[model samples]
Target: MTLTESSQSLDELLKPRRLFRRLIAVIADLRLAIILLLSIALFSISGTVIEQGESVAFYQQNYPEDPALFGFLSWKWILILGLNHVYSTWWFLSLLVLFGSSLIACTFTRQLPALKVAQRWKFYQEPRQFQKLSLSTELKTESSSSLIAQLEKKGYKIYQENQAIYARKGIIGKIGPIVVHVAIIVILAGSIWGALSGFLAQEMVPSGATFGIKNIIEKGLVAASPLTKNWLVKVNRFWIDYTPDGKVDQFYSDLSVVDKEGAELDHKIIHVNKPLRYDGVTFYQTDWGIAGVAVQINNSPVFLLPMAQLSSKGSSRIWGTWIPTKPDLSEGVSLLAKDLQGTMLVYDKEGNLTSAVRPGIPLEINGVTLKVKDLIGSTGLQIKSDPGIPFVYTGFALLMLGVMMSYVSHSQIWILQANECLYIGGKTNRAQVSFEREFLQIIEEINEAQTPTLSVANEIKN
Candidate 1:
């Protein structure tokens, strides 16, 4: 092989490494990090505005094409962009992972080195070195030991080289930014884990029904199926409580977690805001509806009829069913109930309001004595399992702690004693006025005879 060709080949091999370094540098840049965070925020807001993890028909009905939302967003566009499942989408997770990498890179490449420099102490040997400090001054005072004692009293750690001295306090201030970066990275980890392992489902179970989790609205890429345990949940009873004015106060579901053989393991009476949690799975009561009603005509067996909720614009809910009074099913009456309060409105064959009756009341309709028996109710529940919640909470706590620690000023002072003249200087990350006052006190104590020379405190006497 020719030498020129081999050199070109080697350059090609090294090109990838050079490109990798450039990419890493760009990712570690603060501007890129800000842009990434903003992009994530914008997309998160989109996730909220557009309903997530819903059926295709729901999106189609809600975001139809002819007069699209925002003049452009249709259901097809939403589906194509994966906006319906933003949190679980690959691009969203990629943004999170990339932002976390940036944080880690910045912590190692910038923050750690900066912290190391702040903690390392070196005495200022030359007068020119002390001249560079804004707070430095040449005091014709000889007492350097008194300065060290006063600094120590003010919570500064002292380091000395021959007659030159260095003191610092609040090193935790330097460490705080790094802690913040770590906390953010931990939060990202939790979010990624949750998006990859959590699951959500909804169930509308009738009273006295037993079933395993079947309908999953959304599931992570690696979610553990809730059906793995083969556990069955039975809705022992469902009911609604009403106020004196007949408004629904609350609804409840008596539930039991059982095995395949119907052996009960755990039980709870769940209502709104109160849920049943078992083995990392939680069931929240969300809604309630009438399932059916039972009726009997004189001496005949009780017949169960399924009830369907009617459409209404207000909070008034009503479920209705038609019961045939004649055997040929030619004549019938409609039974409608607004609540489980035993009161119902009976409608005649011509849809006219016939009578208002309650359970156990005999109402003569179509030449028969009909008695209302019972009303069955159903409970709607939302079930979810998120294993990353603990990590997210821990990271949140660390973030708060780190933010508080960052507020502390990392004050540093340098004093060089050359023969009779003592050179003193100091700097701090925050609270400039307070640090200046403290520096003044240290100076005054070091030279009790001569008025201390630092930032002029002449206005103090005024």
Candidate 2:
């Protein structure tokens, strides 16, 4: 081959190596990692501050454009930027993958190499090498075996050569940062997985009713349909416990999981903060409502009147139903109940207050005897399923272990006996004061080992 052709071929071969090196350098940059972390934090804060998975009318009403929220956030911008569902957005997930790549690059390029170097056995062969340590001292001594025994007593892993000894401890600390980075990456990946494979659903089922999951407000892009369950859920009964003042203290629902033939598979009574898990899906009791009121008009068979929720300010809820007082349907009375405590306010068609009534009570309203037999209650449940919870939990466990391991201080000591002078020094990556005190105590013990019996042994050997 001609010299010019050989040079061109060599240049072509080096281009790929140069590109790979540059890529590694960029991904392992500390500044890039910091920027990515800060960006993730800021976007996470945004996701928390903004409510997610609401209808368009809700956002338009709450975050109007003319007077936008915080002077910049509007319904238009929220939908445009997908801030409503920030965690599941493509850009946010891309940032996470990029940050994870950076962590992996740094672990391979810097942290692993450092740990390998720390594990390597390097004997300080020359006295000058001991001088390079942060703490060093020269003692007029000859016996290196006594120093080796003292170091072994102090929990150091020892390696001995002809005249030099090397001891190290806390090598696990060097591996801690790498584990921490891996744990964070795992957590991020799990979060992304959950955002793509989980679902959230809400249901308002009346007492003594069987239903399938259908009302899904928010779900992952690739989540399985919750309706694929082989079993059905039945709300056997719903009730509330009232305080002494007739206020709602707690609510509960009796639920049953039934198969296609209506045979019960499992049953449980669930309340707030206590949920039921079945086949990876969790059901939580979130709300309670009045489904309907059963009433009987004079000599007429009892019939159920469906109650509708009335909009009110604040957190209080009220449901109302209207019953015809006459067969002609010309006059009627409205029954309004705030809770399942069996008390209701009765109003006439003319908007005049009639009387207060309770269940199993016969009341005379609008010249007709109206009897309220019972109030049917309904249970509202929130359902959720996530396949990534185990991964997240595992990541958190590893993170705690890594944090504890990182606290351990890695210390190394090197000693050499040359020309009747014992040169010794040590250093620590952390807790320098403690290491210094330990090093001094070891030196003091070595000084004490030079006894008269040892000198007689030396004379006997001569």
Candidate 3:
């Protein structure tokens, strides 16, 4: 073969081999584990620092360009790679999956064996081996059978074939690590599953407004009920009562939930803390907003505002215009009113006037000044739907139960036999100090019981 062709073939063969090796190295590296942990921390901080799911322009406007550093965390690649939304990032998810698998693998390869070793009970009569233990007691006595019988009476199965006694307590003590590791696996799996499959939205449906499915924050991926295609909800009336300190003590909404095509599915009165659930979708009284408002002029009269006006022929058209106080004035205002700033304008039938008004301030028009008498505030609600939430909650409950059980473990001791000399030992799966105290008490009791009473004849002779 020609040298050029041979070199190319060698390069092709080596390239894939190098790539394969690199991939394996990356997967096995401890740094990857550290990276996963750090990423979790980073995401947690990010969630707290920056408002998530904001518009792209918001980040740009807020964080201006800097010559030294990249544009204030602005990277086209970030959006494309889903770094802007780290919760949905494939790499982050992959890290979680890897960590979960590692936990499972570690459980099987390391923890399981350790647990088995801990669970297994072996009769070790060697004093040297017993001396190495964290807690041990050596009792030397002339009669081995009596000592073995004493241990048996104490609820310990003692092996006494050799000169020394062998007994073990709390055989299940070895299984602690296994249970903990497996529980960790279950918890992590539940968390990941919930993150991927759960749907949560906080939509403020205004009173008397029907909401379409897409109007909610979590829209696209939500499934429809088999019986009803779309879950329709209408907020009939929303009431919020706050404490004297302005803290929201309670809130509720009178609502009617319907199926697609306007069929009443259910009626519910949901509150801030109480939610209505049906067909795997939970309807929460999270919030309410201004669908439309009755426009009042100087608090004198109210006018129903139309969203849009349509022509009589059924063609849609919107008609509305802001009327200044002085319609005849030439110019007295800038057209913009946003960001808490109200535009000031001067206008006279054939002349110009100058005046400025903030949103909360009043403006004089014609001859009288009009004030913004009231404002209708919108409500904020949080909604969540997850088929996996139950699993997640169950796992958390189990985790808490296991921790409490391990922390508050109950230990017991039984005295097999007590003769002139006896064997004493107790087993505890948790709180070794407490177990030791209990065992000491038992030993003390046995010693007291074995104490010989001075006979009356011997006492009188003395």
Candidate 4:
């Protein structure tokens, strides 16, 4: 081959090698990993601070154009940046992918090699090798078997070659970082999978209502499959308990999961913090409101009037409904209720206070006697389908395990027997003082055992 042609081919080969090295350096860089972690944290915090999956009207109302929040953030920016749903954003997913790639690179380039180095046993063949250790000692001994026993008693894996001996403990310390990286990768994979295939929906159903999964607030890109539409939910009943002092104690809803063939699959009494899970979907009771009230007017048939919840903005909850007293639907009394305590405030058409009446109590308004009947309650439920929850939980468990394993100190001891003299040395990745103390204790035992043997040899020589 011509010299110039061969040089060109070599250069072409070197180009890919150099590029590969550069890529590895960038992915394995600790600083890059830290920066990516911090960026992920910052975006996660933003996701928490700013509400997710709200309507455009909600954002427009909260973040107006005239005066934006923090002097910069507005509804337009939120929509454009996909801050309305941060976790499912393409950029966030890409960040997770890059961080995972960094972890893989670091694991392969740093952690595994370190573990292999730790697991390899290298016996000290020469006396001078003892000088290289952080802790070294010299003693007169004919055999290293007793010293090896002492090391083994201290929880070390022993390796012997002729007159040389090598021992180590806590090999898991070297493997811990790799396990941690794997756990983090698993968690990231779970999060990414959830973001891709999970969905969130909300439902406000009155008692005795059967409904399908509708009103999706947020859903993943690939979550609109037929599996989400296969099941049905039924809110059998909803009620609230009141304390003796007229405060709400707890609210509950009886719910059932139904199949496509109208068969009940499961049933549960759902409350706040106590959710029901079935078919990878969880139903949580998030809120409750008054649906309607039944009332009898002047011995007439009982009629149900739907109650509308009034905007309290941060105040107490209140639901109101207008009851027509005249045939023209002009003259009516407004009923306002604050709780399920069976008490309501009645107001005349002129907005004047008429009277307060409880359930089963009679009140005279506009010369007509009204008897309050039962009040129906509605349950606010949040439904979510996340297939990655198990993997995420497992990853966290492994993370804790890795953290514990990392705390163990990997220690190594080498003993070389040269003629009648023994060279002993040791080192540890952590807990230097403790290892030193243990090394000293082993040396003392070796000296005590050898003293009797030396005395017997001296007696024989005499």
Alpha-carbon local distance difference test for all models: 0.90, 0.91, 0.53, 0.90
Per-residue accuracy of model 2 over 1-462 as CA lDDT, tens digit each = 999999999999999999999999999999999999999999999999888776788889889998998899999999999988888889999999999999999999999999999999888888888767999998887888888899899899999888888899999999999889989988988888888999888999999999999999878889999889899999999999989988889999999999988999889999999998888889999988899999999878999999999998978989998999988989899999998888899998887888999998899777778999999999999988888787889899999999999989999999888989999999999999999999999988888887775788899999
In terms of TM-score, how similar is model 3 to the real structure? 0.62
> Cα-based RMSD of the predictions, in order?
4.8, 2.2, 10.6, 2.0
Candidate 3 residue runs with Cα over 4 Å from true position: 1-35, 66-72, 75-83, 140-167, 170-173, 200-204, 216-228, 239-252, 261-263, 269-276, 282-289, 294-383, 408-432, 435-439, 453-462
lDDT of 4 by residue, 21-43 (tens): 89998998999999999999999
**TM-score winner, 1 or 4:** 4
TM-score of each: 0.89, 0.94, 0.62, 0.94
- In model 4, pairs of residues that clash are none
Angstrom error at residue 2, model 1: 12
Clashes of each: 0, 0, 15, 0
Per residue, candidate 3 scores C-alpha lDDT tens digits across 275-387 of 87766677666544333323333545544432222234544222222334443644333222211112323335454445544444666665655543322333445665566
lDDT of 2 at 167: 95
Q: Which candidate is the best by lDDT?
A: 2
Q: What local lDDT does model 2 show for residue 180?
A: 93
Tell how far residue 130 is off in model 1, in angstroms: 1.6
Residue 311 deviation, candidate 2, in Å? 1.7
